[model samples]
Target: MAASNVAAPLSSQRPLAIEARGLVKDFDGTRAVDGVDISVPEGAIYGILGPNGAGKTTTLRMLLGIIDPDAGVRRVFGHDRPHEIGRLIGYLPEERGLYPAMKSVEAIAFMGALRGLPLAEGRKRGLELLERHDLGYAAERQIRQLSKGMAQTVQLLGTLVHRPRLVVLDEPFSGLDAINQGKLEGLIRTLADDGVTVIFSTHVIHHAERLCEGVAIIAGGKVPYAGSVEAARDRIPAQVRLETRMREGAWTHALPEDARREGDFFYFSLPETGVEPLLKTLIEGEAGILSLSIERAGLHDAFVAIAGEAAARQLEADQAGGGA
Candidate 1:
């Protein structure tokens, strides 16, 4: 299936926490976000994935009401956005924000208060969250004194301290190390498990695959694919890689329709008919098939296949214009 045909569920008929229709954004005569629509169901961990400059951030900004869309309708928790957004959502922008001179605990509590949390409860929750994220020891440390990773953690904690119904995180794992990355992933999952609708943007496709139940892959200012992770994987052809200890003269041409050689192994796409025939053919051909298993397409492969197609189309259009 083509990426462009991958459809997201409709918000109007579904119990959605976030919805946008015909979203459009223009910057200096260029369409940054073009007629995009998004629907995030309640309690879902949703991902907005794309390459750099693919309008993923722009769409997110518009959704958060940080920037206005030139055209479209948007709602958060069924409330009109940019207006009622304050009551329905929490946002952690790609650019981290914290007052440099403020202590970590003070900053987090202040952020929670800004989101409508009472000072006492906000301070208590702020301390708890900081401890949960392993930033408790740094609570008294000023923002400027903390390392980059520590600062980012403080900002993330602030976003979640208010416990808003919807959370929009832009590149939440941008600068974290492996340990911190795992920690953030855990927090994201925990939030979703608690019934918070999460809409996060990232260039790291693997994180989306691991953390989100559904994802929207955007390219060239449009959503080329959007659906459940399983559905996305299903759209791509399933293949298998086989490693064998066959003699040097063994022939593998008798393999399945999409079979090819990569070093000593044979790679082939599994036909809907099954794997028995392919295995039998290899055995009959005197190929020593040591191990064989189906190779599932990873999110990286899916992104490459979908985004590459869009880029090719754009190149073709540009060339045609040049010729004209």
Candidate 2:
């Protein structure tokens, strides 16, 4: 992990909203975020994606100033982080921040007030948000009385009541059912549409794929892939799988350059030449095609490929160091 000290002032040009250069954090002896460089343009819905123990939570904590990085510079809304974090950011931690004994309205209002909102205004916004999230009737209900999903909704409402410029959420969908997940995704989109910069971390790749305009995939505390979803998919190969009941010998010669057989199915890599010749050959061979479809690499595949490569490299390094 890189370490440096410069304590530079925030940028005068439209405050970055959030920026971290060579951010590094260590817990005990293990490095959590190692040399991470992240920049979120104002009003961009950026996603930080990684599997469990990928240091995503730690990175977000560093950004929020909940936890200090051992090294590197972090700024939130162009101000030195944590020092001015409350003024420009709203955070929803993975472990929901609510007092279980408190009523829904009280919990929401308390969170808003923590961000400097007056109690009366916080209560008004809390009630409105609760109603919007379909939990208005539960306003008087204690947090402990709510289901996990309902509590999650209240937590989200707390995060938004202040309407901070940048909202940072860590695994906001962890306890949500499909319906609640959809609801939260919609709300996130609405927030971004309202010109709020949203940065969130999630292990659920599909949600990130659907919600984020820009993404950074972190593995082993380092970003293996970062870009738009389309660009990430473009980094992988394109192939097509054709499943057929045709005789094995009949279409053997019609296979593409990188074709492979799995039982009755033929998985072929589409060559630059085109797929026309292969289709013609199969048709001429009188092959009974059960299904034929183009297979495009998805975000999940790209994530696995990149993370797998990083893990492999780490393994090799461990072995080399051991031998030395």
Candidate 3:
């Protein structure tokens, strides 16, 4: 691991919790993260989103100072060095493991000790965190004795022992059932409620869509959109579909020229004023409305729209191939 030394950033006036400016990384001559820039607000849940091999992990590693960027600068809490921030930030990597012989409490304390916390203090804090996470009874259990979900929770407990202000979880929802995934979502929300800035990277857009206030979509080692989640969704227009028994007439003329028609159904992009007026107009008229739906664009749609369908297809292919 490369060590990060404290250095004053050129601008100390920005109040961002995490900021990366034109970050770039290369491996064996191929760029993994190319000109990526991101700004994470304080006390917000932010997500770096992509499919496998989109360089999400590489970008995060650079920001955490685990690896130096080939170009650009990264600052967390206005400091250029992660070591300078130390216990102020907690990191949970995608690959999780624990010593089979180590007790849950002991494991947590060990992680804390690496960040300069005394054993007694670390244990005290670790117990509190474990209890808070509903793992109080399992504190003394060895890693090999706990269930898979319980062991994962214990590993997460170690990440929280020092009570860092910023927590970075890489693919935190991976390898868990839907129930456990929901539990993880709640835990993330609770952490943010305590004023901690939470940054997570995930290939699953559903998780990011539900939990993140802002997100950055990375495809092919490039960021297509970075800002509020709403902004990403707004990049593509919502789709309106009208399925009526009455198909052809003045009502059909109401649809845009680009509207796609199939039998008695009409599908088109929602107008700026939205479908309400159109619905009212149809209802006032004698058009027998069987079904009408306006499907708002989701993060996944936005990813395809902004990053291009080819990139989305490639991402899916990479995910299926088990590449990251």
Candidate 4:
């Protein structure tokens, strides 16, 4: 719950995991990221959510030191730059690949070696992760023989082989089946529970709703909302819907003027006076209330509200394009 009651621009938690202040990036005079600010609390799963071309990957790369930001500051593990903090963070880029001829374990161990891990230790850790992730048998197999999902998991495992403190994934769920996505969600939760800070980028709002305690919604090269999932949802008003058998005009005065009526249900915001009095009035008026429910806005609705309807539509169109 990083943004529950933000007293300042950044998180107040001790030993902050990652921070980027007014980050901006440009290429060929076109800005991909513009004035973005983010704070990730230690030991929490944070999500960077946006539509395609929303500057998520650019911001992530800036924070990871893969590409330098044209403007602003980024801090990784209390350092101003990622140079000395390379071994402290694990990064999984959206682009996925490996040596097609290499064995799975060999690929993973090779990746760990680049992160300053010894070959024997990296192999041991890779084996442990393989067994833990139910891919022990695949360790001996070549990368070319694995399915797309399995290969993606192997890449993620390689990123995590050295057990870095902060794990940043870019579109980790892309091309994964439902089962693999669920398993990855569980793996993220496990990492947080183990005191690791995770930050991932995704266009799917539901993933952030289910897995992250904090989220940043990016749109059109800027962040419109960043904080706890609860706070983001709280940005929109709750909707009260009731289905009634009696559709007569008798209950009209009891409801708000802005209420909309559908086939069998009336939908509107609950008045400040509360639902109890409204329900009582409906009952006394002899309105047959078949069903009544109050539902808070979900992450998708909140994202649309915060990030703009255009961005949401773009995300939907992007999804359709990917599926096709």
Top-TM-score structure, candidate number: 4
Best by lDDT: 4
Model 4, stretches more than 4 Å misplaced? Answer: 1-14, 249-251
What is the TM-score (0 to 1) of candidate 4? 0.92
lDDT of 3 by residue, 141-249 (tens): 9999999888888888888888899999988877776788888999899998998999999877788889988888887788867778887787678888888877666
Candidate 1 — which pairs collide? Answer: none
List runs of model 1 lying over 4 Å from the truth.
1-5, 8-14, 243-254, 262-264, 277-289, 309-324
Which of candidates 1 and 4 reaches a greater TM-score? 4
Each model's lDDT: 0.80, 0.78, 0.83, 0.86
Q: What digit string (tens of lDDT, one per residue) describes model 2 on residues 1-324?
A: 211211222122444677887889888899988887777777778888876677889999988888888999888877775656585678888877678899999888888898998889999999999888778899999999999999888888888888898899988877677899889889889988888989999777777788887777787887766656666665567788898776575677778768887887788777677778877888788887788888778877766566675544553443334321
By lDDT: ranked, best first = 4, 3, 1, 2
Return the TM-score for each candidate structure: 0.85, 0.79, 0.88, 0.92
Predicted candidate 3, C-alpha RMSD: 5.9
Q: Is candidate 1 or candidate 3 better by TM-score?
A: 3
10 residues in a row with least lDDT, candidate 4: 1-10
lDDT of 4 by residue, 59-84 (tens): 89998988989899999888888867
Pairs in steric clash, model 3: none
Model 3 ranges off by over 4 Å: 1-14, 276-285, 317-324
Q: How close is candidate 1 to the true structure, as a TM-score?
A: 0.85
